[model samples]
Target: MLKDKVVVITGASSGIGLLTARLLSEEGAVPILAARSRQKLAEASSGIAGKHEIKVLDVTREDQVKQMINEIIADHGQIDILLNNAGYGQFESIVDMPSEEFGRMMDVNYMGIVRCTKAVLPHMLGRGSGRIVNVASMAGKIGTAKSTAYTATKHAVLGFSNALRQELRGTGVTVSTVNPGPIDTPFFELADPAGGYTSNVKWLMMKPEYVARKIVRFMDSGKEELNLPLKAAAAMRFYQLCPRLADRLTYRMMNKK
Candidate 1:
């Protein structure tokens, strides 16, 4: 179903987005990679098969996002899918995290999706068909210690995606959110500069390709949500049912950083 479809993925320079691009390209989909780093984007796309394009986009900037989408439409004629997979985590207690850093997280992680989606929605609505896949996190589903800003941003993403899904329900544009547990990616190198979080979850982390494959395979399948590692999802569900106990345990485990 993805064959020859024009799919645009933000954060395509690395991690899940890069892996998804490779998989989609293998399925004959035209992948348009968007990221802030042109050198990294070029390097990442070099090994992917089939036709692909890259756009240097910092999703926080409305003008840049608008320009990238416009250029995409001009080149691809239409966009079939948009994957809002650009985000990062900032692991720190609320009191310790800098206000500006927290704000940047909200800007890049939350507003970034909003900007890109708004830029592409009109085109999708005009065409009367499209797919939007948001790469959310398990933190969005259940709060964890040391993720105050990160969790808030992801929660906003989930809320935004859910509301947008309802608004576009009858418009043929489907929205889906993928909530994956900790993935073994360079994300942590930045999110946890001290390596505490990574060390704590290294054994539990899922590979980027694994998560990416699942997303690329089912993104347009009309599914509303995808949660990784049934075990983690089950635990999160339990947490939702018993917030006090579960949250306390999680806090103790992840607060060491």
Candidate 2:
């Protein structure tokens, strides 16, 4: 149960993270909101029914992450869960995308998770009880157009989750990863300046609230590797099995990224 449990969430200012911050708090969980945008985090904090912490954090900076984690641990006494969800994707072709931009993506989307995990692992392992939920994307499993760097980071998230799961096998701590399909959230707007997109036609496009509810539910279940919107997972697998035929049928006919 999430009730009264202290959980720290990153990338918590908007979109799925914001929805989760509110959801968890209402369900009786103590949410510690971590993000770079103080204004946004403050605004999000207002929506929750109960008290929650708002910690300003820039995940790309390891020093800040270390200090922030230690501060939360110091204040809260115990960190029950760490939600590694702070990330964004840049829409561009690999050739035209600046290498520096790609590096920035890895720094936040991949290294950020790494830094936070390292900061919390000792405490969790020492206590022999904790939960770490990482939010990846469908792009982690299937290739998407215009998401080369984003896809790479998400893929790295998958690898990181798998390895960490193995390392914590005997410990009381639990690690779970979620791969969500297209959700009707600010992410698409953040990724594209345009108002309309056809690529998001599939799966009825879940809402952020829906995703958050499912995540909290799964957390209660003590599950590993939640493949959300089951149909998408099945389709990705089916596409992979078909090889070039799938690529030609799926990507060859659609917009890149």
Ten-residue stretch with the least lDDT total in model 2? 195-204
Encode model 1's per-residue lDDT on 191-252: one tens digit a residue.
98888777877777898989988898777577899999667889878888998888777776
lDDT of each: 0.89, 0.85
Worst lDDT run of 10 residues, candidate 1, spans 248-257
lDDT at 235, model 2: 74
Model 2 regions lying over 4 Å from their true place: 196-204, 240-245, 252-256
lDDT of 2 by residue, 1-257 (tens): 78988989999988889888888888898999999989998898888778798999999888999999899889988899999999988778889899999899999999999999999989999999999999998888887778889889999999999999999899999889999977877777766656444254543478778898888888778989777687777877877688577777777534544
TM-score of every prediction relative to native: 0.96, 0.93
**Highest-scoring model, lDDT:** 1
Quote the positional error of residue 209 for candidate 1 in Å.
Answer: 1.1
True-structure RMSD, every candidate: 1.3, 1.8
